[model samples]
Target: MEKQHSFWEREEWLKPPDLMIIGGGIVGASTAIFYKKRFPKHDVILVDKGIAPEGASTRNAGFACIGSVSEHLADLAVSGGETVFSRIVRRWNGLQLLRETCGDEVMDYQNTGGYEIFTDEKIYETCAGKIPWFNQKLKERLGLEDVYSEREYEGYPAIFNRVEGAINSGKLMRFLHERFTESGVRTWWNSRVERVEPGSVMFENGFQINPKKTVIAVNGFVQRLVNLPVKPARGFVFVTKPIPGLKWKGTFHFDEGYVYFRNIGERLLLGGGRNVAKEEETTDQFGTNQKIKEYLTRFANVTLNLPEKWEIDVEWSGIMGMTDNKEPVLQEVKPGLWAAAGLSGMGIAIGMQLAKELVSKLED
Candidate 1:
């Protein structure tokens, strides 16, 4: 009788919210804030399965970056010149919006610049030869003549860009959370949403919430609730204990961004290279893969020239949503049910921009 009663019981929580947003990561949190700001009189509720915002928002490499040099070139090859340039503009706009909304101190935003190391001599030569040409093309968009160059920084062979920067990922999310609360937006952590019905939502725990409008911001975890072509791509990362005399500074990307690392104070935080094993890395599961780990380690030694004696103090992984095309889905799945996901690993910048756009759609 007790078990049956638990299954049907609805706790004395408020009846229902006017707006309920699923997945309290960067995208969802931003969406909730946007809705609350637009409709101050209406109640807005945000839900997440974890005690804190999970998935890629907190798990990213803290790269306050839009694109690396070679990575931009690779994107042009795949997406064409027009598409690649347009995407870069969008990323820049998103970054600007994030800074304006949250402020630099709150987000720990820094413009210490970034680097791309070239371990392979041929790739290095190719990138060096095209630096001027690439810079000329992006000059108008970036408002800078020389966007990249071979600069000797510390002891690494790196191509540096003065435009990029980094941020404290954890602090950024917390700032957004605080902003939401201040705006009278309600959030329910550790609340697992199972289904989204018209004007209502069913929770895994026996609680059902009836909201006038719902926005799904689950990102890579969307497959759990809807039938989308989005799939999860796992990114493995590890941080080193603070080295007293670490020479490297700023962010670094190699092998066309397949491998990436950056300096956080005196410690090194490294991640990426899932392209080494596409099939195995494409899963909703959040765990470090041995193959990717080995590759990252090898890249660290060869590219960054890290000593084998260095200890890996922490290791973790986060899943990113990817689709056939890199564009995110920001449309109403059904009447009263809107979704904004599939960031293709560019969630930090794009998610914030889309969140504002999503709320504007609802207001219309």
Candidate 2:
């Protein structure tokens, strides 16, 4: 049964807000923060279906990276040098913005560096040959020198990115949430959105709000509300039981970043194999793909060469939005309706910056 609102609730708390932000992930929270800071007098409310962010924002592998050498080469081929280099700059600047907004200590950010390991010698050689060019371009763009260097790790050919690192995803989101509340933005949890029209949004629970403006920041789930080019890609992750002598302690990627792993103290956290079965993984639903899991399991055993009997302690999957060009989608879908999504699995690196830019557009 619907509980009718009292006079105080209807007139005050239940009244339509100045802005309604759907989806409480990094984009939504950052949007609220920027907007509230700009207009403290206006009431803003952010709603999410889960108690916490349900998408890749908090569920990701916590890799604070721009792009690996091999990944960049592949992207450069498809997107051209100019587009690829511009994206690299955006990612680098976005990472800086995230660290500045939520402090390094608060998020347990570590400059442990990132390594792109390769088992195929030919692929490794090709990537290594492009290191100097990549370094020169990155230096010119980001004012950072020696960004990529050829290296060897555990007997495998690797290219180390000196600027890349890792962070605690949960803590990052927690800090963002604290900032969201501090900025006087209201939050409505477990409130799944049923529909988002031009002027009003209806919740799954039958509650309706007619806000002056609405922003959809659901990422992978954006398609559920409106038609867009963004598509959902499910990625799986698993953390192993404490390995007594785990030595690898930094972010690592392979197979053009289709697979990645890192160390959390004495335990190994591995994720990403969606490229193994792209068609199957391209759905909004959340579940593990056995084929991808099998591939990753083989990689952990054969490529990573873990302890003889290492075991997975926990495993889960997260849904991320993907675009053909691997760029975020930020635009007004219709009058009074806007959307910001398709972070392309780089939410940690670009979510905040994208939010800031979106807020600027909303201002106009």
Considering every candidate listed, which one attains the maximal TM-score? Answer: 2
Positional deviation of residue 305's Cα in model 1 after best superposition, in angstroms: 1.8
Candidate topping lDDT:
2
* Candidate 1 residue spans exceeding 4 A from truth: 2-12, 153-157
Q: 60-127, model 1: which lDDT tens digit per residue?
A: 98887777778887877788888777777777789888889889998788898888887567877777
Clash pairs (backbone) in predicted model 1:
none
Give residue 145's lDDT in candidate 1 (0 to 100): 69
TM-score of candidate 1 to 2 decimals: 0.93
Give the alpha carbon lDDT tens digit for every residue of 63-120 in model 2.
Answer: 9999999899889888998889999999999999999988899999999899999999
Q: 357 in model 1: Cα distance from truth in Å?
A: 1.0
The Cα error of candidate 1 at residue 320, in Å, is 0.8
lDDT of 1 at 79: 82
Question: Model 1 Cα displacement at 184 (Å)?
Answer: 1.2
Residue 114 lDDT, candidate 2, scale 0-100? 97
